[model samples]
Target: MSVDDGILEHMFESDFASADDKTVVAAIEECARAEAMLAARRLAATAELTARYTEPDEDRDHLAVDGWRMASAEISAAMRVGDRAASSQMCIAMALRERLPKVAALFAQGRLSAALVSTITWRTQLIVDSQIAQRIDTAIAQRAGEWGGLSVARLESAIDSLVDQHDPDARRRMREAAQNRDVRLGKRDDVTGTMSLWGRLSIADGELLKRRLAQLSSQVCKDDPRTAGQRRSEALGAIAANAEGLSCRCGSPDCPSAGQDDPRAAHFVINVITEANAPNTEPVPATPAESATAERAAGPVEPATEPQAAEPATERSKPRSAAALIIGGGLIPTPLLAELIKNGAKVQWVHKPPAAPETGYRPSGKTARFVRMRDMTCRFPGCTRPAEFCDLDHTTPSPAGATHPSNLKCLCRIHHLLKTFGGWGDQQHPDGTVLWTAPSGRTYFTHPGSRLFYPGWDTTTATLLVPTGPARHGDKGAMMPRRRRTRAQDRLRRIERERALNAIDRKRWAAPATTQPSRPPPQNDDPWKITTDANIDTTDTDPAPF
Candidate 1:
């Protein structure tokens, strides 16, 4: 049993059954698989060992500045591939929770590195409490650099002002300042001067004060664009009248009915006297000087009413032109509109007759909406203002052309009027260029150079060659019409070009199969080179005998 078993095992394990045969190939393949597995296991073990050796220590937070710098860079690098926003927040939190205290204490103890301290301070501020947040915000603002820089000193000054202004104790000073004010004078439609009340405030606090003033003014006074001093005086007067026991007697504040018997309406009489004494108040009508004085004493005042004008009888009978009737109702198409714009034409839509059915002449609202959506701006080559305020023009006369996209272009009011009513005419070229004719009959052409034409682009596909003469409207402008080509001819030409390209491609594909792959052309050598195929000796045997 031992001799027979040993022979069988040796035969199976042998590399070759005979020198000419490869029965041992199976054994060689099995050995190769085992070797590959062993190599992979060795690589895994080496990586594990490297990671174990380089793991950071627990007490590394207390390490020197160089250690912290390395740690921060490592942290940043690890986070580089994570979600950016989340990583930023995590970095701030990490700096605040981990590095901030260490850096702060180190700085306090004079043990921190400048670079580490600065970086930690910035990161820490990102997650600090609101009070410290405000301090940081003020610091940024105070630096007063281009946009977001704030110096420490400037920040402190701003904070102090904010604190002082909001303090209740400062109210008395504000009141005192208010009391020392004088009314600012302003012009009015009436003889009497008006008042304007408002005050200048600092930039940072101006918005806050203006907001408060608006609320307060809404409750107590009118915000006339008049002088602020006048508004303030009026405000003070109102306050005084409301004060205990010094009220006057009139129905309205500025009433001329002074010394009336209305105890409940005191502010009215006071305003009347005040308005009367006002130097800019209107003069009473002319009369004997003695009686005028008596009338003034009795309280002279004009009735408050809006001015009115008397209409003449002929105005009602005036007739509007027919063009006004059509445009007023917006009865026009859009495509015809764009074409008109390209041709530098405009319309004067006239109503055929008002007695005609409204259904026959009414326009679609899509006219305006489509114009806005398609030609969003003025279509006059370089004019880019929005088309909302533009005139929707028709290139061909209405009843002659439909409002298709090809017919419309938006022109601003001035250009619209100039092209329409103003004597200039335009012509569209076959190449998509535009030729314009001035009132003087001189022509100017716009040559569109290298402009690519896609479907729906009304301009020409070819580069436009501007002509040298008058480009009139209609038949006169039809110079150099584009030539039409047949599809068969175009197809033939394309096939010929493709044949030339296919010959080159066949040569390129066969090159490597027939010869060694080409090396790159040497630097400083001519790229356009001619090469000949090498001839190999094949006299003894054929390569493809099978």
Candidate 2:
């Protein structure tokens, strides 16, 4: 081939590689750059539409301008996928053909957002049958002399009120049907389950059960670390060990052995046999080996540690504070510590902090308990996760600032990592709003209805009361009402909740941070768990039966 021919062939069939590490990296960077540019162009187009269509300076002419702007914005957004020139022609055609109000009063009065208003107008334009929106628009246009001075938002609101007055059930039916549709699509887990066993099962439990079963089906043949189901099964083995005494090996379903109903019995029996025969408990009063191991693990058991014996309750409840062990250390700041104390929090220590800037150091679990309870989820716009499942994100780093309640936010693992490590530029406003500037320079704000606020919890009615304190070292304070502290089982429940929630959020974004769902259906709506005071006791709840 000639030189030009060779060059053309190389460009089309480059051996640079379809999946080379360096080539893939470069491709990703280039794609990101392209996306950023496209987003910028979209924003610029929006700005132009606003400038050409909105007459913000003229109060009386505002409705007409708003109508024009709304139409332009809708057309522009829809045009993002099509030929811009053709979309522009269609937009101009519709703009000239339709008579829209000069000012949309409800919009100016804050009844709606610019995007929502534009969307409504766009929907009306694309409607093949419904003349309701068009009729409303025409009515508004006719009264431009009287309502022309009103805001676009106000105009929209007025139309809605008129529609509602004529047919109140119209909006209600639409809303209810939309909600029901969401519930059926597995998009809303709450409505699916709300009964004692059946109700909640139909709602959140059923969905969770489905997800768990799917995960198990995919994991059984893997060689990685044990699956969640295995861990839970093993933990239950410790509790269910004594249940076998009540069981009979009789073949009848009526026999207590029927309760076993082992799903993975073939493989599980072999594993159980291995565990049972691994080692036996030491014989007699005490064994030196067992004693030595206990001493090494927990130092020494003091003779005085034995408390006065008390009557045991019929039902034993799980422990409130899941701390591994309480230990002593030099005082951290009191304000910071008090916030934690006021919230029922447990800590697990690492003994020392990270020595390098590159190493990410998080607070022990005790601190996690505090921070997680404080902000509950990502303070970023539209993000949602419960505090218990969140990472304790320091709004400002130490050495530059102190660890105060205001400086902490509970973000899910994804948001935390994104803020700490990703190139996303973030800031917290003085008023506690969070703003994120995307790579495209589009600013996203988490304000009043955004993800920045934590719903304050009322835990006073519970047996475990987080103390009110003017804290001091050596303060014994109030002991927890119960001594049982292992909550690893409950931790699994939280993990499940996080997973379900992550899934929903992922669906919303069309791109998920993790494989899990964004938000699980609310626990209050689950059927299988004990529900008292709208709280689901996840501690003892079984995984939903698929």
Predicted structure 2: lDDT:
0.36
Model 1 lDDT, residue 29, Cα:
56
Q: How high a TM-score does candidate 1 get?
A: 0.19
- Give the range where candidate 1 is weakest over 10 consecutive residues by summed lDDT: 319-328
lDDT of 1 at 71: 28
* Candidate 2 residue 326 C-alpha distance from true site, Å: 27
lDDT of 2 by residue, 251-299 (tens): 4555433444332211110000001122322212212222111111111
lDDT tens digits, residues 6-26, model 1? Answer: 887887777365645354576
**TM-score of every candidate relative to the true structure:** 0.19, 0.24
